[model samples]
Structures are given as C-alpha cells and as structure tokens.
Target: MGRLEIKSYEKIKEFLSEEHVGRIASIDENGYPQIIPMNFAFVNDSIYMHSYTRGEKLDNILRNPKTGFEVDRELEFLPSYFSHPTDASQADTLYISVVIKGKAVIVEDDDEKTLALNGLMKKYQPEGNYIPIKNNDLVLDEVAVIKIVPESIKGKYKIGQHLRTDSRLVLAKKILKRNSPTSRQTLKVMGFEETPDGLKMVDEPVW
Candidate 1:
C-alpha cells in the first residue's frame, strides 16, 4: 500500500469506467481482506457496484464502506525483460495499471439508483434485449445498488514512464504505430499527434 498521488483524474477515471468488470475488496469477519470481481458503473464522480442485499461484499460494506478497488487494462506483460549492451537498465514487461481506495455507499435515491442500473445494462447488454431496472412492488425489496465514493485515486502507468525519455518515446510509437484506443492513449501520454492507426489497433493493444 504505497502512497498514490493523483495525476490526471480523467485518465484514471477512464480506466475506472467504460462498462468493465472490476473487483471490490473489504474486510471479513476475521478482519481479513475480502475481494470480489463484479460489474460496475461510474457516474457523478462516484464508482458503483451492486449485488443482492446479502453476500460477503454487501455485509462487509454495510459494516464498513471503506474499501479498496481497482481496474486495469494491461498494456503488455512482456513475458520477460532483457537489456542491450548500451543500456544496462534495459527493461521489459510494460503495463498500464490503476488502483483506487475509497468508501463505498449504497445509493438510496430512486432516480439515481435507476440511472446507475441503466448505465450498467447499457454497457453490458447493449445488444441484448433490454432489461429494465425499476422498483415495482414485486422487485423493489430484492434488488440492491451500491456506490463507492473514492477518497483517493492513483494510477500507476508503468508503460515505461520510468525509462529514458528516448526509450519511452520509442515504446509509445510501437504502441501508436499499431494504433487503437490503447495506442492512441499511449500517443496522447507521450504528447504525440494521433492518427488512424490508433483506431486500427484498438482491439489488439491495451492502454
């Protein structure tokens, strides 16, 4: 648990968002850590995770909303790292990761709760037949939605940011040349002009 400084809130928010599955960590009865992977939504600068009213995740949060959560799109695992003669510190296995710590609260507002659920469905089931989230007499009590208010969010982008500026530039291009949203992100981080290549490699690379 290192101290995480906030960089661009938007960058980390992008990783926190986008209809992706994320994990939630809480404390269990023995005071040990409990983590669960779940689908989530983000709105109003708050992170959202929901489940049935009962479960380890729900129980822990009810007792304590403070928790840790994370979402990341690994840029590259590299499988291994090597060094050339000139660069003794040559590195490998680059990745883009974002970690967050915050207090999670269950959303109580009827409209907000409904909107949060809608956001989830649109992202996860955009093409499937629509399933509406509502509080009819039959379904209101059984469904529950939880919201996470992040006190601190820190993104550790190891995409060779620690490498020499020259090396970082080269790696950014390698990602950009392939081009995709991920590559486009790499380009933007490197302050490079983006092109059509970024869109092409969108599926191939993770930023």
Candidate 2:
C-alpha cells in the first residue's frame, strides 16, 4: 500500500499529543550519529525536552544545532497469513510516524525555561498534583531545557489507505472480529466510520 502523508497542522499536533516519547538524533564530537529516546512536549509549533545540565546530548548540541526528531505510534500488526496466506514477507505493522528536521537551542532565559517545564508537567501530569516549577527552584539550575524549532515537519501513516473498497471492508471485518483496542484504533485510522446501518468506509483515511 502507498504511504499516506499528513499535512494538516491540527492533525499533526493531535498526533504529537498522543505520543509521549520521541527519538532525537544528533552528531557527536566524533562525527558519529547519537540517537536517544526522550520525553518531549509539543507547544507553539516547537518541541521542548529536558536533560541534565551536562550530558552527551548537550555536548552534541553544543557542537552542532541541527538535529532530527521522530515520534511514532504503532496501531496493529497485520500478519501475512491473514491476507497473503503463503508469504510471510507480506507481514507488516500499521503505524503513524512524524519526523522533524530542526535546530536545537538551549533555553537559558528563566521565563522560557519555566514555561517549557510547565508545558512538560501539563503534558505528562495533567492531574496537577505536583508543585509548580519556579524560577528560583534549585532544580532549575541542574536541568537544561532544549527547544527545537522545526525547519520541516512531515507525518506518515501506514494504515491501509491504499486498499480498495472491497479489500478495506474485509480488513475492517477482520479488525472488528479481533476486537482488540489496537484493532479498533486501526479501523478508525483506516477510515471505517460506524453508521446506523453498518460500518461505512470513507474515500480518504485519517492519517
């Protein structure tokens, strides 16, 4: 199936909100690729993440500001046996992925740091039970906030968007029979809308 791209800002933001972790890639001093997983917050069309005051990531960023970040959510696994009975190679997983090419800047301003930390708290702990971050907090000195301003952002979803109507219907029925949460989510991503009569397929799937 052909890959589907998401170009809508709102849709991209929604997908980013649904994902909590992202992989960030940078170049180390040796000119080697350094990739690490990080908890991130998406706000104001920028990505914010925190780290210790000193780390390999910080060192890499100091040497080079250009970086790549990616976030992805796996929907469901489609086994080849379920479709192409003879070819295991046909097996694949459905997922939504977003990639960002951006410049990373260390946040030194107290107000900006506080705002970024607040954004992180709101994202991971909407329960609002923790103490609010303050500029005077000693921990602020120990932590480093990094903000990524994206030069380009691209999103892709592999959820059977290229499937023909009849094939899509069969897949939807299979997904329903499976009845797992992931299956249900996959159905939604595949543009299967529930109607009074039955599940209706849309011409375009939601990426």
Candidate 3:
C-alpha cells in the first residue's frame, strides 16, 4: 500500500515481466482516463507497446505523452482462510501490484521501430519460429509506436511483508502445496522464481 519497499529494481522488473499484460492509462480530451489492455516488453528499464495506425490512445499520447500503467496479482485465498467472528480485524489478503508512470514518445525512425519490434518479439516469441519484422509489416509512415519512458516505477507486494518469519514460512508452504490457479503460481508469485521465457504475452513491440 505504501511506496515501494521491495528489494531491488530488478525484482520490480521481473515482476513486470511476470505480469506482461498491463493497462495503459492515458488522458482523454476531457481529462478522463482511458485504459487499454496491452502486452508490454520490459527492456532497458522501460516499457514499450505497439499500436495500430490510428486510435484514441495514440491520439491521447500524441497530445500528451504522460500516462500511467498498472498490473496486479492477488493471492488472498491461498489457504481459504476466513476470519472468525471472534477476530476483530479484517481477514488477510496477500497480493502484489506494479505501477508505472511515464511520458510516451512515438518512435520516428524506421530502424528504431524495427528494433523495438524485434525486442517485443524476442520477449514473446522466445520459442516460436522467427518472423522478421519489416517496416512494411506494421511500422509505416502512418502507423504509431509508443516508447514508454518511465518517469517513475514502483511495486507494492503486500504478501505479508510485515508478517513474522513463521507466518511467512506458513504462507510459503501453502503456496507450494496448494494446487489451485493462484497457489500453483506460488513459486513465481512469491518472488522465489520467474515463469519461463517464450511465454506469449504480446504480439509485437510497437514502440
């Protein structure tokens, strides 16, 4: 909940890779928030997303590059622990979230665009057959690519950071032993490890 107190930026970076599909929030003409689910590549400590030739998100970024993105994972029911009426405090909910704020700049040069697209492919296509990205494929004179230069990046992992060592061990065991969707992800979810590469989280790097 508070400002990020996690280990290192590498941890945050890994988390971003773990959670590749984040929502990009841009400001509409009337100052409303426009969020679109996007597959992003975390490289060089920055995030990049591709876009079609035209759209509202592109317009908003062109008008104002400042934007915010968020991705989160909740692991509350790892044990299905429900608070008893005798307990006064609320039940526990373990979770983690990442927030990034930045100014987006559309890649202007064709070479840069191609490189960005390749980076994106490498991120998602670690195992898929290689398909060279040509400027003609997507990046044309009209198509737009947004490189999100993060002004600020943060991660809040509320998975009992304050819990005593014993409680943490208990949680870890639960994560390791359980078989549900959230629990099965404990190793990667708890920062103990990362999901393997070649995971298809995005189509291409647009920016």
Candidate 4:
C-alpha cells in the first residue's frame, strides 16, 4: 500500500545477482522500444549478457547506445479479500525490482569479453564442471558480449513493511497458510523468521 524505495546499494546488487532473467530495452529504427528478456550477470558494477553475433537488439544498440535494463522478482500475490472481502481495488502483489538507465556497447576487448563470459558462467553454473573461458578461445568469435554501463539505478520493494506490527504478522500467517512454493522466501523477505513458536518479526525487510 505504500511506496517503499530500496536505498541500499548492496541490497540492489544482491537482488540483481540473484534474479535469473533481466529485460533489456533498445530503441529501434522507427523509435519504438524493443525489449528482450535474457540471462544476465552483474559484474564489476555493470551488467553483462551474451548473445549471438547478430540480432535486432544488437542493431538497435549499434544505432543508439542508450538503453534500459530491469530485473524483478514477484514474491506473492495477495487477493482483495486479504484486506476487504468485496473490493477488488484492495488486491496487491509483493515484489522487489531494480531499474537502470545506461549506455550499451558491444564489447571489443578480448580480455574483457573473457572476463564477462566467465562471470556469466560462474553465476549460471557454479558447479565448476566446465573449463574456464580464455580471451583467445575461438568460441569468442561466435558470441557477442554486451556491456551496459549504468548512468542511474533505482530499486523498490513492497512486502507489507509499512503495515503495523500486528497487521503485518497477520498477513504473514495468511501467506504461510497458502503455502505456495515461494511462501517461505516471501516471508523471509518480509522480515519474518521461523521458530518453533511460529513466524516472528526479527528485523526490518532487507530491501
């Protein structure tokens, strides 16, 4: 119900690193925005993504480097009845999101490309089953690494953190009762800890 801005830079970076997919927007020849959802890695204060050597998104970026990128995780969906039995307007969702305005460029340096690709592999495949990437690898010729240097970043979240203590506890219990796959993580995000007694508010929401 309240607009809670996430002001912590560390938390924003954590969220971005954990989120599986991010949407990147690029302006087309006709000035329309073309958006694509792809896997990403956050490394060295920039966003890195690997793609085929040629595509519409690459074309757009070459024409105009300005871009927008976003990553978000939807934690829970609270129905209208959670607040009011008959008013649909009371429905709300819990989520954490980050947005960035940046300039994108196709990475040209071999060592940087190797670093970015290896960073992505580390994020997506932490098991260490594959060989590390090298600058001189022939595979580099087939893949294009896009780097986004962020000009501005903003993060926001909503999880009943603005509610009174008692009201927030009640909402947490309701979420637990529903017991969806994301319930525990959602409760954790809302600052609840599980104990033998039940869920307890141990701290403020992390983001």
lDDT of 3 by residue, 1-207 (tens): 443256467778777776658899999999999999998787777787778878999889989999998888776554334335456455566777788899988778887777777778887778869877886664456556678888988777765456555565556655555556665454444444323641121221111
Return the top candidate by lDDT.
Answer: 4
Which sequence of candidate numbers ranks them by lDDT, best first?
4, 2, 3, 1
How displaced is residue 113 in candidate 1, in Å?
A: 1.9
TM-score of 3: 0.77
List clash counts for every candidate, in order: 5, 0, 1, 0
Candidate closest to the true structure, highest TM-score: 4
Model 4 misplaced regions, further than 4 Å: 1-3
Model 2, C-alpha of 68: deviation from truth (Å): 0.5
Show the lowest summed lDDT stretch of 10 residues, model 1: 198-207
Candidate 1 regions exceeding 4 Å error are 1-6, 79-91, 126-140, 169-207
Better of 2 and 4 by lDDT: 4
Each candidate's TM vs. the true structure?
A: 0.70, 0.90, 0.77, 0.96
The 0-to-1 C-alpha lDDT of every candidate, in the order given, reads 0.66, 0.86, 0.70, 0.93
Q: Candidate 2 vs candidate 3: which has greater TM-score? A: 2
Compared with the true structure, what per-residue lDDT tens digits does model 2 show for residues 1-207?
235787677888998887889999999998998999999999889999999899999989988999999999989887786678799998878788999999999999988899899999999999899998998887779899999999999988877766777887887787777777678668777788767888788646555
Model 3 worst lDDT window (10 residues): 198-207
